[model samples]
Target: MTAVLATLNLGVERHGPWTSVGRSGIDKRPVDHRVQARTWGLEGDLIADKRVHGGPDKAVYAFAREDAVFWQEELGRDVGPGNFGENFSTTGLDVTGAEVGEQWAIGDAVFEVIRARKPCRVFAGFWDVPDLVKRFIAHGAPGAYLRTLQEGSVGAGDAIEVIRRPGHGVTIGYMLRALTTEPHLLPRFLDAPEMLPKHHEKARKWLAARELEKSNP
Candidate 1:
């Protein structure tokens, strides 16, 4: 199945009431090629990482497809690349199922799903929803963070196809849910060999804690 973009959204700097603030221009329907050029031309490759600004975290640069829904309903519009502050907002593909190191080809560019994004205060500030962060954590829909594996041009209506899938069966959603809801059970989820490096770190921490408990007891 192909994941079609139901909405695309974007935000730069803003703060206000949650519902009202969320209804801004950040979430709107995809514009024609002309509109895309004016509002989202920078979204193309080479400039995709411009937002990162050399932060320690890579998640800052991009967001996954599922997270765009919040903006979609908020703005009462079909948001896409130009609206979501993302260089490439896509649909049609199970993002949660995308494994770390696996590559995807969208139009002429290629990107890798690196890890699950961790929402920051900036998101809360933008939406003006105090509980937004908590809700994101609770829902564990942090969305997938990606790195540009290959750079090229991309735009709306472009077909996204999975070029590879990791041998590991665990999905990004499965790991995020485990981390958020049942952190204590994280080790069990790491049974899959394909778990990403971050998940490996979590598993190590859990094992260490368990070992400490055994000795202390």
Candidate 2:
């Protein structure tokens, strides 16, 4: 199957009740021209709340157009490109099903799949949906965050080529479910070392706690 980068989105600072730091970069919009993507993040993108967002581990965020359309139907509204604050809007790709450690080549850049997006209150507030966070978790298509392996220019309509995929079978969707609704699946993430360090630590802690509970009980 062929996959493509449907659009490149850049985030701008927005201030409102939806913002955690009194400002948020979740208000992303599509850009018509090519944009530079660096190891840090895409050029001209504003990232507020640095404590929890943005960095090398999450230099890029990708959301499949299919998933966006699913939400559009679910919400009865236009959940268009960049609406999810994704840096890359993808088409013909399984963004959530993509395995952790998967690498894709787009334009002249290479990005490695790192983790799944964690829905937050800001995301729910952005859509004015009170139960969006809970609903989003239930839907389990949280998209994927990427780490930039090579910096270069990227634009809309660029073809996406999967360069490498690890056999761990730990997908972005699974990771989200494991981290959220199904703690029983947490141990599976341990096999995918390509995952973000924080998640590995979380799984290890969970495993340790589980073992302790078994021994005590």
Candidate 3:
């Protein structure tokens, strides 16, 4: 399958009414030039909240244009690139279905899918939609968060080539569902070792709770 990077986005720091800290880096906009992709994130992108956003495990957030279109119809508005605070707006990419640990090569950088983008209050606040988080969870296409494996320059129109795909079947969609609405699917995350440690911890807790329930009942 052919996938392309439609746009490269960089966030700017802004004070917003809905943000807890009164400041957020959710207002990302498209950039024209090639930007440096570092271990933490794309250079020049503002990451205002380090507590939950921007880390080695969540370096680059990718959202597919196809997925955006789905939202556009539901929202009755143009869900354009960078509107979702994604660093990489992709076309012809099955980002939601991408397996955890799947490696994609774009420009000179290699990125490994690590987790799903969990919708937060900042996201809903950015869009000014009160129930967007709940609706996004219901939609279940939370997009993919990647960790940089090779730092290099990346630009819009870069061809995204899938270099590796783990057969574990733990996709961003499945993981998001497991993490959110479906507790039964949580144990399946164990098959994907490339998943973030926090998820594995959640899976363990779910299992322990289940075991306790079974013994007590």
- For model 1 the TM-score comes to 0.65
Q: Could you tell me every candidate's TM-score relative to the true structure?
A: 0.65, 0.97, 0.97
Q: After superposition, how far is residue 88 of candidate 1 from its true place, in Å?
A: 2.9
Report the C-alpha displacement of residue 96, candidate 1, in angstroms. Answer: 2.8
* Model 2 Cα RMSD, 1 decimal: 1.0
Task: Specify the poorest-scoring 10-residue window by lDDT in model 1.
Answer: 34-43
Model-by-model lDDT, in order?
Answer: 0.53, 0.91, 0.92
lDDT of 2 by residue, 1-217 (tens): 6899999999988899878999999988999999988998999999998888889988999999899888988989898789998999999999988999999999999999998999999999998999999999899999899999999999999999999999899999899899898998998888998877778888899999999999999
**Which digits, one per residue and each the tens of the lDDT, describe model 1 over residues 7-30?**
333334333453332333232234
| Ranking according to lDDT, highest score first | 3, 2, 1
RMSD for each of the candidates: 6.2, 1.0, 1.0
| Positional deviation of residue 46's Cα in model 1 after best superposition, in angstroms | 12
lDDT at 166 for candidate 1?
71
Per-residue error for 85 in candidate 2, Å, reads 0.7
Q: Write the per-residue lDDT of candidate 3 for residues 101-131, one digit (tens) a residue.
A: 9999999999999999889898998898999
